[model samples]
Target: MSTPAVRIADLLEDVPTASNPPAPLPAPDPGEAPRTGGSTLNITVVWGDLTEVAADLHVTGHYQSVVPAAAELALDQAISGGSRLIIKEHTKLGWIDAQLGEVTYFPCKAGPVRSAAVVGMGPMGTLTERRALQMYASLLGEAVALGHVESMATVLIGSGTGNLAVSQAARALVRGFAGVLALLSPPTPPPRLTEVLIVEVDRLRAEQLHLALITAAESLPQLRIAPRLREESGGRLSAPSAAVYALAALARLAGPQSTPTRDGPAGTATRDGMPEGPDRPGREEALRTVLAGFDPDIQGKVREQLAHLATVDRTDLSLAVGGSVGEYDDSAQVRMSVLSGVGGLRWAALTGRATVPERLVPVDMDLLRELVNRLTEPSVEDARELPDLLSRVVVPPDFQRLLTDDARVLLELDRDTASVPWEFLAEIQHADGGRHDPLAIRTQLSRQLRTPYARVMTDALGDAPLRALVIGDPGDPEKGFQLEEARSEALAVAARLKNLGVEVSLFVGAANSREPGVDPARRLDVLRALLSGRHHIVHYCGHSDFDFSGTGRRSGWVFADGLLTAQELALLERPPLIVVANACYSALLGSATGLGRQAQPSGAADRSPWGNPQAALVPSLADEFLRLGVGHYIGAAWRIPDKQAISFAEQFYTYVFEGGPGEPAPTVGGGVRRARKGLYEQYAAGRVPPDIAPNPKRWSSWAAYQHYGDASDVLVRHDSSGTTGGS
Candidate 1:
């Protein structure tokens, strides 16, 4: 028996191999006889095209469906000349509609690689690290079964348009390879595949894969991996250069239909005489043209915004506005930048102002607090103060200019401003000379808090059906904190989610006859359910408390026996993707001393620990969830009526999964906006029940809800089976 060897080699053209030596592997002992039964394996990471690699097998990923005529994959495009042959082979073998982790092999007569293996990675939206790992393991198992594979080459599977990070895919590949090797036992012959080559075309991603592979190898000493680096001409453009070329080509195509224009009103010809219509070029051309006009420094900032947008949704307008807390209690320094891509495009356009690091605009924190307080108040006088408060809120002119009627706004705010309901702010004027329409109704608005620990989860929820843990009225009625309508709300939400292909676990606090007088919302059970990491969403329709005297970490949802504090939730290693905290002040991140008085219960004021005059501003349940890496947290900034809360939840989920058979998935932000608009329209039509909202002049409960996550996040993705689930 001999030790396995692994090397990473950079295949630079005409470069001396001696300049970048491979890590030395231990020589076999002279006394040891050559083992003919189990073959020793060697692994290498190289920067080149998969088709050019000389190996027994070449592996690539394919979606569940057969490859279409117009392929979007880089590998498919690279091998376009032989793609027809591959497709024909696939059809002949009945390889259409493959399942995730399934692999099929076909001989290749046109490429350096003797044969190729195509592995199903499910749909584009459903590719995850787990699935990638499974696919890799299956590829090896199938290769071993063939018994002819001596060497193999593969692209880093799921790292391209499949939406996986390069490092993640690389790690998954390494782990999968190791897992197969570990399973080889006595009487079960080890795979004859000795050499494995990982090919990557993009220089940057290749470097990332190289590092990731080396790191993965270091963790598993049994693999005995050695690393080397080189670069060679693979006759393919790097990702950046390819992107630039594509954009240029698109611009040329778009030039004749609509010319690039200077600043002007949207949907109309600009001052530079460019026409705006349905026939105008896509967002790619518009973004490139707009970006080219900016100075290098500003362009860099705009590109940063674009990169941020790529993680969520790239087509929506992104407005990142935030500030550091100031020396004074009622004032803070603010800055803003707006990025947009009006149509389907990979790049983003700078629509508003670029952020000026040196020039921080001062904003009145008092005005923002006043706005939240006013919205919480149930008085006509307080509601009338909205226009004045909004005028004094210090929104940037650049941001104001970008606020069009049809804009899909992704608003990123700082902790100081997170509590302020920006959705209710009416920046755009109405056409009929009436009160301005709120941004929530006029535009699809979503919010993200600019926190240090917040992150966007790129991996899809695994192959399992989407799951939700719905908790309603978790507090006992004897505690004087029970929500009368919350149980029904939970049932309705669970039913709707189930209809949309989500596996829902519903828990209600009150004892029921069906359960033989047993309560389902046990604290231990709820905690275990949340920490299980199986559920994609956690919807709580009950009472929640915010600790103004503390840092808000102690604040939590009230349960049957105890409060499930934010401090406890922070311990979750795999937090749910979305959390809907439909409770009073669940999203409030400011001083709660003077807000939501009308909605508070009798003696609720006495329960507050606000006697401390030195109490500082605190984070909300939403803030804690985001900090712990929940992708989206929808919560109310103030007290919301039970009926309004139910209506909002139904509307939100309905819009989220509203897509028909083959339509594109709707965004989380879009759903929130539609839900809010539905409530506002109801109010406008005088359909509001007087008991739910007594005063027409008071700020509507619809505006109390705030979405703290990527507006572009699609919770449910449509599939070929006509069902929607978290992908």
Candidate 2:
């Protein structure tokens, strides 16, 4: 009986490489000049050979020697051996003169990880590195989904330059972890510039997660950002820098009307039917677009590259050395990876190999350089600072494992779980539990905060005497005061809070300053009242962006003139559900701007982040609410269809209050979620609904389906009354 690892290794050993050579020539070519003329002597020289011997045969173009890849030959031997594990002991060239010392014969059924193949930096190195990269990428999706593990790992897959690069290997590490964990988690990382993703790749930041990247690359970067960034998309990046650039490109393409494929590989050539961007500008049909501009020979889906790496054939090469053991001279070799070309035809190439006599070699130096540059192109990206928005990420079980292990602090609460941490945050302990009736007045703070309840409460509410708080657009008449109409909206919201058991008054047109930190003051006032045991709720609507430039005519809510970064928002204590009527157009438009910031993102070619609104409070509003303590926020990244917006809000409150007893609390965006179901119907009725059906014009965002606070924070469910639902 064999272990899963042995079984896996056996499967790995089955891979094939370059073609094998036919049996050694029975005799030399007649065209070959005899060595010392020592022939069989029985040779009745052919008419041409004897007649034209030396005159033409020796100097004649009668025969040509084809370059054979040594890497391919050794690879063939390993394949023939049929071992469970394959190891290639490559030099700086990733191979010996004969298959360049490539050895793939790991036959262990299962054992502690012990084998490795360190490829030097050269053509052979590059070949191995590319094979490894494609292999790692293909298995990544599955590895994450299923918490599988790989006992052995290999390394030095050409990050040292030459043909292979240390950075390129770094850029392709999906499966390397489980199948090759620790084995390749370089005890050290390469130069920061090696980060192919961002042009100005930050080495300082990525190095921190280099080791833990197997589990934390994408998640941790966003978490550690001290200042809130506008674009927080650190999606499933192979590396932090590449992820940054990939994100930048994704953002640029994520126009309000652009719908790029978020699920594809890093070098996913196209989106939907469109090319990655203007790089391959003419490709209009997304799916039909060719997969290579980076490397013409590169083909196959991400999945194929992965499988090919483990077991490829290489038998065409032949090596010959003529130098002394220690002080010898120049030698040459050839290598190739056999692959099927178009139309079920055969295709292969001399990846690299060293041979003696040098005559066996095939590729000219110039050709090898050309192939190397081409293969390395696509992975190289234009990166910059990644924003703090919630971008797409594939959080596999491995990612989960890393988080769980590193969090160091475990705290969970359920409808029935006991010992909630309500005592940590003060207001909850002393105040009359208002709208937040479901779980009792408890604060949800980071488990690490060491402050006593008294201190935290005093800090949050301040010494203000009284007055329930109300948050909403001031609706300044001078600024086109739609106060009367806006007042109606707030009043409606106030009514909803009351129905949720909030005992508070509604300041229909509350006047609070646009002063910086003013929110804390107003919120503190309400907190004081609640601590003294008053009940209250909150509601608001206006424009907002993650950054705050303070100059745009259509500026969203601004804390200060040019402040209000996302960090400030996320730091809010005990923030409540928030709703914004005039959210950014992208918020309403799902397909418009994939690039997060106001700046529109181009495709993969010239991915850039030239933020929009001419710096109008640059902070992306979506980022703010997301990071903020707001349990659930309702605001558009772009724009929402009017009817969709209205109905989204309407049914949201309806579900919360009227659903049923024991139902979950409703969230801010509950309405939108529900309304989306009827979107197509609404849109077909004259104007297409925003979120319902496909509307390439509108862009969906991380803000669209993302959630905060708790996973149990049900977006829509019946209320205790069993009729109205909750947000």
Per lDDT, the best of the predicted structures is 1
For model 1, how big is the CA root-mean-square deviation?
Answer: 18.2
Write the residue-wise lDDT of candidate 2 on 551-620 in tens digits: 3222234211222233333334544333234333213111221223344334311111212221112223
Which residue pairs collide, candidate 1? Answer: 6-226, 8-228, 10-229, 10-230, 10-231, 11-230, 11-231, 11-232, 12-231
> Model 1 reaches what TM-score against the true structure?
0.48
Question: What tens-digit string does per-residue lDDT give for candidate 1 at 338-366?
Answer: 21112210111122112222113354444
After TM-score superposition, the amount by which residue 508's alpha carbon in candidate 2 deviates from its true location, in angstroms, is: 4.0
The whole-model lDDT of each prediction reads 0.55, 0.26
Q: List candidate 1 stretches off by more than 4 Å.
A: 1-359, 364-367, 377-388, 428-434, 455-460, 510-519, 547-553, 586-619, 660-663, 693-699, 717-727
In model 1, where is the ten-residue run with the lowest total lDDT?
Answer: 325-334
Relative to the true structure, candidate 2 reaches a TM of 0.27
